[model samples]
Target chain A: MTVQKVWSLFDRSQLYECYECSKCSGSCPVTLAGDFLGPRKILLKCLQHGSGRVIRDPLLWYCTTCQVCQDRCPQEINIPELLTGLRNKAAKIGNIPERVKFTVEKIAKTGRSVLGFKVERERKRYNLPPVVEISKEEISKILAETGFFKDLKIDH
Target chain B: MALRYAFFPGCVIPAKYPHFESATRAIAKVLDMELVDLPFSCCPPTSNMKLVHYDSWLALAARNLCVAEEQELDILTTCTGCVSTLKEANYIMRQKPNRRRKINRILEKAGRHYEGTIEVFHLLDVLYDHIGLEAIEEKCIYDLNMKVASHYGCHLFRPSYIMYPEFLSPSHSYVPTSIDEITEVLGGEPVKYMRRFLCCGYPLGANVDEDASYEILREKLYYIKAAHAELIAVACASCFEQFELGQVMIKKKYKETYKLPTLYISQLIGLAMGIDNETLGLKEHIHKIKKLLPRLQERTGRMRATL
Candidate 1:
């Protein structure tokens, strides 16, 4: 099967460990705002529906990545991490908002995510502190050490 | 003494922000942790994740983790965004062996695989666990009285598996005291705040709602102002950008004002180490944390007077 079929085999089981404690919902900053984004419900969606629905739902992005859900979850579920997975799953299903995609593209091309703010120009705003660049040779050496080349199956 | 791993510097710090890397490097060296700049690419490029084509992002992040695991020393990243992405990919890959295997196969083209051999470490954990505060304290030349507001950023504190143990407190203002202690060692007070540990409006970067985003910053500044924070310090580079830039937006939009600057934990530690302003890149800040420079020296003079 293709990658989609393989990913279909996994979902909510990988997402959280809610014992029905409702702390995730209770502690959620967004939930306090009267949204449907309570951690408990998200967990339930992922657990019951797996990535089938949880991944693509806009309710997923409402998460602030606030550790409140994780902190309050008695099960110690990695809520934000799970949120990321679900978000990733949704994105796979074409659930992404347009602006987010553009941000991602910009980051991929230039290694800087936001568009058009040449840092060299604005360094004065929050005057940059002394920065050290990771030299190409250094990155090459890192690739060699991590066996990163072999693991990624790259020629470099 | 030679520790190496794939380094994912992420978008914020590597290009526009450099002090974070410089300071992390300094602390890593003193702690004897050698960081290697890895050949990994961006973690799905933020908003680029296909609401439609998601595997590409997961696969992309997995490719980076696979490279690190292949290297055998674990992957190390400085940006909160990068750390969260790589760690999450490693988690997903580990959970689904077949998925991990598939991604590994893709990485095989790049000569990497997620065999679960490589782990991920945020620079904070690296410093806390490996370097230890005792080692860091030995290097401090001046104690600080800097009253700071600590922003842990959402990515670092959540997913407690990767974060330190102290952050589980529900009512806790500041998440960790180690950074506060670092400021104290340099004579700056790491002032605690009601919402000191809250989000830094960074999650809004990928999302386009600037007004909604401004609310987050404005909300945060409300507490920062109430707490009388001299400077707001951050561990995450994206957060550093949010505060440094967000304040400018806030000043323009709300017609309210905040002149405080954000400091990288590394930048402050560099100061405590007596590394000097120019060496620490103090001049390039948008809000210019230059005023605090004199305070650092004033503390030094105070110490001399006491002596």
Candidate 2:
């Protein structure tokens, strides 16, 4: 894969247009809830420092990607997209949260988020049809081909 | 075009809240809307999974869309999160050819291609936009004259660029009113409350900080109670869990009481249409609908008799 392909993940030029305005922070649910730094500060960190610093911060995981900051950003900067890119890089370094790792691993291996037994019980209990089964072989191939397994260090 | 939709019941709903799935299907039958289930995986919730692997998220979402496109039918999602992820994916892949080519290149491994022929809608949108409020009014058998609060979860509204076009009107961009209109159509008064657009704190509450997440829910419940809301009607499964179960968690943790019953918008709609409570799974709600259903059933029986 070319460096350009990796760069495309974070290639939002609108991010550079940010003038340190706190409109994003003002509207951020995380910042308002006092759980995480607002989008403005995170973006500022990305501007002054590289994503390396931003990616490692445990606070990055707090963002629900609610998109309020991105919706309210005056500079048209796509903050959520940028945050996702940072998380991607973080995942590559194995800095992901355990809960997220569990979900991603389950999807990668089984092509669904939760275990099948629970769904089976629910299906039988509700008298609904069986849950649709995804072809795990195909999903694994797609994930491997897209370098997603490599990114998450999932064994193929 | 007899109102048929390829139903995308996202992962969580079937596993965690099967009652929601039951109620949605029962209500769809009442409205003469056909819900055909498709073999689809998760919408790959953007809350966390997408944050880690954008390419995987796009490819998975596009693959789901391809299934709906293969059926040559638009998707009708039961969860707000699924609609948001799938709708944004449709918008991006359809509009950007370069990105589409990139995703398709990966999708070829799964033997799927996303031509973007399908559109995505939350059940709320299908009720308000596709079915129309007037038709819903005519079908309504019960007058739920109680004051209800609309919890239009975060995914249904923000990221305006991707979802704004579907808003009721160009001027209605800032405030989406489909759920509110559906409330009135069902004969319930939609109560306005502070921070109506706030996140249910379910994603973060469940994922990152349990305490902070509960605090967010507590704050919303306080405001809803102050607004004199009898119940909180939510369009998202995650939000429903946050309010219904989160209320219990709040009581356990802080000894605070918020007896607000949270219902899926579909559950409430089914109730007003005189669908039996058992079929609608009204009894499955964590905060019991035991007290509220009689009032609705009594009114519905009287209305049907009069009609």
Candidate 3:
């Protein structure tokens, strides 16, 4: 499917509200420290081309989901939310970076993301009660209902 | 009854920083608040799930909230990311009826509903807004003379529009000095450093661009070191991961030495309240608080005189 066609999946016309003020880019930590494209530029591309075209852009994964862009935007466009929509489209097509995919899979299977036995021992040693596990069966049911397993191609 | 909360320790802290949990429990006892544990899953972790599966993110966080609501207690989270996800999810589900109805539908499969009857509080917010600094001060058995650089990780108030609705209106002054205020009350100097608002970059470390993540961490450490802050006091588990682990990553990846001890806000407060190092899980830190220990002891001596 063409990238623009996929943009139809999201109702994100607030993206079109960007006035190109460059305020979001200016305050963007990723833009400052790394070669990742700034928020304003990403918005410009999405508005000009479409969110689908930018799906494979590795720079999209660099955003820390920090709300600096939305906070600094003069137009009040929710830049992070828009970026998340774009990332959701990316994930739909299996374009997510490996680490993010791994974490997602971990959550899908274990009902929690992080994997370590030390925490269980530490909970005991510290006299803190063990973290109550969310029923994985219930989590899987929700994932299935949300189409998460099918979207990510993870077999339940 | 004291202001009790269903404690929601996000995935990172239990696996990475159990000390944060221990110390929070320690101080919650001192402050007369209950940190009760309940059945829960990920606040679904906003970093990854929000990008890949927005519905899953909202539904998972909503499920956790449903559990808290079932108990009729407000949710208290130690992780900023959890706070951001749960608080914003509550706001969206309640404010936008359609989204609420849609999410509640999916949640029904898990035997949950997003009624939005419960509230979420970050431990820092609970300490500052509920317990009050004066009450915290009154319980202090040790004075901290150390200088602390408070990193109020981004998720706490950013997109301040959602997390803090009052900031959206012109009438409200949204200066985020809560961490600094807490530090002052504990008798630690809160240092002003550049990039104070920069993320600790731990969230990004989970991505392929982990180097860039560490670069952000290095920049913050540089400023904190330059300011000669004794330690970076953080209220978020993710920030604690970055400084505690990111410092080691920096040494190995870039061959730079930045030994900045990152203390969870509760650990710092527990120390000020004269909870011993052993009880605070101070030894579990990857970046040793060894250098700061004697200085803390000296402060404790000062605390004794005042008492």
- Which candidate wins on DockQ? 3
> Over the stretch B1-307, how does candidate 2's per-residue lDDT look in tens digits?
5699998889888888887888888778767788898888878888877877887888888988998999999999988789989988998898889889998988886788888677888898898888888877777788887789998888987677787664533433356788788888788899999988878788887566878787778888889989999888999888988898888888999899889888888888878877777767776777887777667533433343111
DockQ of each: 0.22, 0.59, 0.62
- lDDT for position A142 in model 2: 77
User: Which residue segments of model 1 deviate by more than 4 Å?
Assistant: A1-26, A29-60, A74-95, A106-156, B2-5, B26-33, B45-54, B69-71, B162-176, B297-307
**Model 3 bad stretches (over 4 Å):** A1-12, B167-173, B297-307
Task: Rate residue B230 of model 1 by lDDT.
Answer: 87
- Judged by DockQ cut-offs, the docking class of candidate 2 is medium
Candidate 3 chain A vs. true chain A: TM-score? 0.88
Cα-lDDT of candidate 1: 0.62
- In CAPRI terms, model 1 is classed as incorrect
True contacts kept of each: 0.28, 0.56, 0.77
TM-score, each model?
0.74, 0.93, 0.93
Model 2 segments beyond 4 Å from truth?
Answer: A2-7, A10-12, A116-118, B166-173, B297-307
Clashes of each: 56, 0, 0
lDDT of 1 by residue, B152-235 (tens): 777665555544434545543225565666666556777777756666655654463455566767878888888899898787
